[model samples]
Each structure stands twice: as structure tokens, then as C-alpha cells.
Target: MIVWVCYSIVTLIILQFCILLIRIDFYWKNHRATSVELPFVSVLVAARNEERDLVDLLLSLENIDYPADKIEFLFADDQSSDRTAQLLGQWCEHSANRSFISIDSSQAALYNENGKANALGILAEEAKGDYYFFTDADCVVNREWIREGVGSFSGNTGLLIGITQVKAERMLGRFQEIDWWLTLGFVKVATDLHIHTTGLGNNMVISKEAYVKSGGFKSIPFCLTEDLEISRAIQKKGFGIAHQVSSGMLLKTKPEASLTSLMSQRKRWMHGMMTLPLYWKLGLGLQFGYFMGIIGLFIFMPKIGVVLALVKMALQGLFLHRFAHRAGERGSWLYLLFFDFYSSISTLLTILYYFWPSKTNWKSRIYP
Candidate 1:
């Protein structure tokens, strides 16, 4: 019975991986670059104690290739105990097109801030744009990020998710970089299938019409992965969702500072599990437990386990190659072997941490 279960798990995962590959080419198939005049855009950033990296984001925003006459910037300092507020203040003063809001714990409690959600809620209220583009403080978007993102949207698209990668050069960073490509590969195909799609918090855009229809952040039930929740809300409103992964729309995020930090980050993401439907939840469960499934097979039937693992790796390598090309990234196939080994450990740790009793700490705030 155990052997049968393990075998079933391996087969389903491999089948799903193959399915993604088949539909992968269909992603962005509907995207047609148009010369139509774009709508006014409000660029929003939510920062909490991001002093160390806020400048990079500010610089990126200042250098955006979008027309200044039609663009505005709104930032929120979520009770940061550092120079984050000061930095935002200085940056906002440089242009009357920019604005900033500071939310302390008292104000957050009064508004039911729910961490980043409240900050974004306030920012959105102050924004005067037909569309809102969001990115994180730890991220550096390309100069063309805004222009490309606005162009990626179709007439009916309410939510657009862009690809984000870890840009660090360390061994750990390389593994995470590959991990992002691999994970988002699934997300991209899911978007194509128009099923199980979620938002990329650090690199996403939502039309004001859709945002208002979704009832804004404050009205959406609070969740740790605010991006995913908001995406689901927008989708529930029957708005079109678009996914992008090109060089123009791609963004870079600083890698988590340590293994502990990464673990916490994953823990927060695991909250997304509670938001998925039963079928998708089960499918994701199989994915997260796939490594364990292999081990179970190994204990029961070594040859079958070995064969399946190798086949899966080969397919993953093929997907990565294509994924790199899609993102215009100079990716290395060497990361395949490294990711194969590293993923086993990280997957197990992420699963274990997700079930632990400790609250998830992200950007210095704790979430249950």
C-alpha cells in the first residue's frame, strides 16, 4: 500500500510537471504589445525598516522610463524604527508627484493595518491613477518596468504578475535564484491555464477599477501573503489576470539575509495553503511532499525511485533552459544539479517550519 501511494505521488508530480511544460508555451500568448496611450499610473511601495535597501528602490523609481506627467509615487512607512521614514521624506520632497504616509502601531491598530495591507490600503486611497504598480523596497526594477508592465495588460486585465529573482551572487543566492525560476515557471503556466493563479507581491500591477471592485486591501480578509489574497480577490471579481516574465518586466530582489530569514519567509508563504481550493491544495501538497515521496519509493523500490528522479530532473532542466530564455536571463544548467540537492533540504525545512508553532517574522513584524 505504501509503495503504491509513493508511486502514485511520483507519477502525479511528473505528470503535472509535463503538463506545465506543454502549456508553458501558451503563457502570454494573448499578450499583444499595443501603441495605445497608457493610463495614469500610481507606483506604490510599502516599507518597514528598509533603511539598508530603500535607496535602491527609490533610485529605480526615480529613473523609471514612464512619462513623469502621467505618473505618481506613493509610499508608506509602516512604523519603521529606522531611517526608512526619513529616506522616504527626502525622496518625496524631490518631486511634487510623490507622497508619503507614516503608520505607527497606534495608527495601525486604529486602522486594522494587518501589516503591509494597511500601509497599501492607505497608499491606494491617496493614489490618483487608473492603475497601480507595486514593488518592494528590497527590489530594484528596471527603468522600463512601469512602461512594460502597463503595456502587458489587455483591455480587461485586472491583475498582472511579473517575475522577480534573487540577484545575490552567493552559493545560497544562486540556489534561490534557480528556485524562483522553477517555482514561477509553474505559476506562469498556471496563469496560462487560468487556474490556481496568485499575485507576485513584489512585482504586480492592478487596475484601479479592479482594485476598487475587489474592495481594496482593508476590505479583503487579512492574510500573511497579502499579495496572494489580493490576487484571489481580484480574480473572484471575474477580472482577467496576466503574467509576465520578460527582461523589461522582470525585477530583482535581495536574497534573504540568512537561512533563518529564508525559513521565516517560506513560513509566511505557506499561509497561501489556506487560501487555495481543495483540489489545488492537494496538488500543492503533492508538490511540497514530492521529495518525501521519492524517499518513500527509495525505501520500497530503489530502482523505480532512481529512474523517476532522473527523469524529473531532465524535464526540469529542459524547462529551466526555456524559462531562462523567456526571462532573457543568462541562466546556467549547472544549477540543476545544485538545485536537485539543495531543494531536498529546503523543501523539508520549509514544510517543517510551516507547521511549527512560532509566528512568522517578516520585515521585523510578526504574523500568526
Candidate 2:
């Protein structure tokens, strides 16, 4: 009975990968590559003690290829004890095209322990662009990030979610960069194929009309997974979400510095997943079954498990090989292999951490 069950699970896992591959192919064929007029865009950034990277991010924004008159950058400082506020003031005093708005600490409310969301809500009200573009304090946008994103809004795209790539400087950083690209790329591709669509908060754009129709950030003011919540809300309202594949629109983020920080970040992500609606959660389970099958093979049938593991590894290798090329990291297969193992262990720890709730400190703020 045990052997049969294990084999059945392994078969299911193989089938899931097959489905994913087919979906990617289908999307590539039917996807509409459209170009639209560059409308006025309000670039919204929420910062909380991001002194180290704020200036770099601001400098990157200055070089964007979009028209200066068509773009407005809004920086919302969530009461940073660091020089973030001073830096913003300095930039605003000198910037010819950007505008700055700081959120007073007294008015900034703690909504589900995520300060970014709180800061975003306040900035949204003051925004004047036809579209709202959300990025992070530590992210550096490509020169064409805004232009490519605005182009996606051509016909009926209500929300445009672009790609995020990690810029790694060390061994740990490279591992994280590879893991993030592989995992997120797979999810984005799968979701584009009628699976489940999720938007990363760091590189998402939404029309102001859709924002109002979906009830704005007020809809998920207290949700830790604000991006996912907003995506679902927009989907519920029947707005189309599209992904931009052009590398020009990529938002590069810094990887977590330590194992503890990585684990905490993963814990927050997994916990947020638990809060997703049932249908979305169930759909993700179909994807996760592939991982579960590998674990089952190790436990019940060593020989079959070894064979299945080899097949699984081959499939993963193919996926990573293709992904690495797209990410401009070709010849880093060996690094990706090790990173995959680290990701598996980290995912398991994240699952466990979700069951046991505890406070975590990040950037001098305590989050539960």
C-alpha cells in the first residue's frame, strides 16, 4: 500500500511539471505583445530607514528613459530614524522632475505589521498620475522600466506586473538571486497560463481607475500580503493582469544579508500564502505536489525514489538552464544547483515557522 501510494504521488508530480511546461508554451504562442502610449505615471516608493540604498535608487530613477514631464516620483518616508528623510530632502531640493512627500510618523498606522503598505496608502491619495507604479526603497529600476510598463497599458491591461531580478555581490547573494528568479519566474509563467496570478509589490503598476474600482489600498489595509490581496481584488473586479518580459523593465533588489534575515523573509511570505483565498491556495497545492513527491520517494521507496529524483533533477536543470539564460546568468548552473537545495530547506523551515507564530525584528521594527 505504501509503495503504491508513493508511486502514485510521484506520477502526479511528473504530471504537474508536464502541465507547467505545456502552459508556458501555450502562453508564449497566444500572448499579445502590445505597445501603448506613455501616459503620466506616478512612481510611488515607500521607505523605512533605507538610508544605505535610497540615494542609489533615486539616482537610478533620474536616468529612466521616460519623458520627465510624463513622470512624477513620490517618496513616502515612514518615519525613518536613519538619514532617509535627509537624503530625500537633499534629492528633492535638487531634482528637476521628481516630487517628495514624507509620511509623518504620527499619522502612519501599523497595518498588519507592514510599514510599506501603510506608507503606500498615504502616497496613493496624493498621487496625480493616470497610473500608479510601486517600487521599493532598495530597488533600482532599469532605464526603460517605466516606458515598457506604460506600454503594456495600451488597450485593456488594468494591471501590469513587471519582472524583479536580484543583484548579488557575494556567494550568499548569488544563491539568493538564482533561487528568487527560478521560483518567481516559474510562478509567473504558470499563473499567466490560467493558473493563479500574483504580483510582486516591488514592480507592479495599476491604472488609477482600476485602483479606485478595486477600492484602492483601503481594501487590504491590514493584510501582510498586500500585493496578493490587491491582485485578487482586481481579478475579482474582472480586470486583466499582464506580465512584461522585456528585461528593460526589471527592478533589481538587494538580497537578504544573512540566513536569519532570509528565513524571516520566507516566513513572512509563507504566512501570507496561508491568508490567500481557498481556490488560489488549492491551485498552488497542485504546483507544490511536485516537491512533496520528492520527499515521499525518499521515505517509502529508495530505488524508485532515486530514479524519480534523477528525472526531477533533470527537469529542474532544464528549467534553471533556460531561466538562467533569460536572467543573463548563463554558466551559473553549479551555483543554482546549490541554491536550489538551500531553497528547499528554507521553504521547509518557513512552513514550520508559520505554525509557530513569533515576533521578528527587521530594520529595527518588530513584526509579529
The best candidate by lDDT is 1
RMSD in Å for model 1: 1.8
lDDT of 1 by residue, 203-286 (tens): 999999999999878777878878888887898898988888888888999887689988988888888766778887787778
Per-residue alpha-carbon lDDT of candidate 2 for residues 290-312, written as tens digits (9 for 90 to 100) = 55666777887778888886776
Model 1: which residue pairs collide? none
TM-score of 1: 0.94
C-alpha TM-score for every candidate:
0.94, 0.90
In Å, residue 351's CA in model 2 sits off its true spot by 1.4
Tell me the spans in candidate 2 whose CA falls farther than 4 Å from its real position.
29-35, 110-113, 279-292, 324-331
